[model samples]
Target chain A: NAGVTQTPKFRVLKTGQSMTLLCAQDMNHEYMYWYRQDPGMGLRLIHYSVGEGTTAKGEVPDGYNVSRLKKQNFLLGLESAAPSQTSVYFCASSYWRGGPESTDTQYFGPGTRLTVL
Target chain B: AQSVAQPEDQVNVAEGNPLTVKCTYSVSGNPYLFWYVQYPNRGLQFLLKYITGDNLVKGSYGFEAEFNKSQTSFHLKKPSALVSDSALYFCAVRDDILTGGGNKLTFGTGTQLKVEL
Candidate 1:
């Protein structure tokens, strides 16, 4: 299984430019999430989807929007890029079930490094 | 709100020596703790997790973590470290809001482990 994979391993954008990130998982996970990693700051949640066609705002959702049209894919969009938005973005997915057997361990992708100038 | 803390910015250890990575968490209810490692410019990889029973949870790459409920801590340990094990380690806790769906995770800043030869 390829597990989770992300597109555009590296990107550089001018301020106010727009772009979208693609995330896909082959594990048939029910939950998908996007996070940003910065130096000295842990990975912060950006947005997540419980299932296909469902999306929810996470801890750091501003300047970012997400769409989960298909179960295997989640897309994160930047309407207008900003310097503060430059960071390494990661996508994670997990198969979660209720009860004791569920460890809720998330599997992450390689990550996309974005730079805003 | 759920949160995790990795107090150390970096930890150095001689190869073949024991290694420890500290982690503390704060949450309202049961805390589902997890450990992930990230290689340079790579994504985070799941190491181990603590869900229900067994305070000592073993995971991939001969790594293990001790879950201390009283201290609200889950520290990762390796009996004998290897130079290849050097990477950035992150501790995370599942958000308690598992009501509707989406098992979101809160991650720590990260601890850089340096295993010297």
Candidate 2:
């Protein structure tokens, strides 16, 4: 299985530029998440989708939007890239059974490095 | 809100010695804890998770974690450290009751572990 894959592993954009990061998983998972990794900040959740056609805001949802059009895909969009948006973006997915006690494992994608100047 | 803390910014251990990475969590209900490791230029990899049952959960690459309910901590440990084990380690917690979802993971600031020979 390809597991989780992210497109445009590296990208650079100028201020006000717009772009989308694609995340795909072949594990048939029901939940997908977008996170940004900064130095010493670990990973912060940006947005998430419980399933297709469902999306929710996460801890750091500002300056980002997400869409889950298909079961296997989750897209993160930046309408106007800013320097503060420069970071390593990671995509993750997991299958949900019930509560935290039911399932909690998350598989992550290779990550995309985005630099906005 | 659920949150995690990795007190140490960096940990250094000699190869072949036991290594410990500290992690503490705060949540209202039962916590589903997880450990993830990330190498340079790579995505985070699932190390292990503590859902229920045994307090000591063993996982891939000779890594393990102990869940201490009293202390509200889930610390990652390895019997013997190796140079290859050097990486950034993160502790995450899933708060089902608060988030009302199974996919939300609150990650810590991350701890950088360096195993030297």
DockQ, cand. 1: 0.75
lDDT digits (tens) for residues A1-117 of candidate 2 = 999999989999999999999999999999999999999888999999999999999889999999999999999999999999999999999998874358758999999999999
lDDT of 1 by residue, B1-117 (tens): 778999999999999999999999998888889999999988999998888888999999999999998998999999999999999999998878554347788899999999999
lDDT of each: 0.93, 0.93
Question: Which regions of candidate 2 fall more than 4 Å away from where they truly are?
Answer: none
Q: Tally clashes: model 2.
A: 0
lDDT of 1 by residue, A4-101 (tens): 99999999999999999999999999899999999999899999998999999988999999999999999999999999999999999998786544
TM-scores, each model vs. reference: 0.96, 0.97
lDDT of 1 at A69: 96
lDDT of 2 by residue, B2-74 (tens): 8899999999999999999999999888888999999988999999998889999999999999999999999
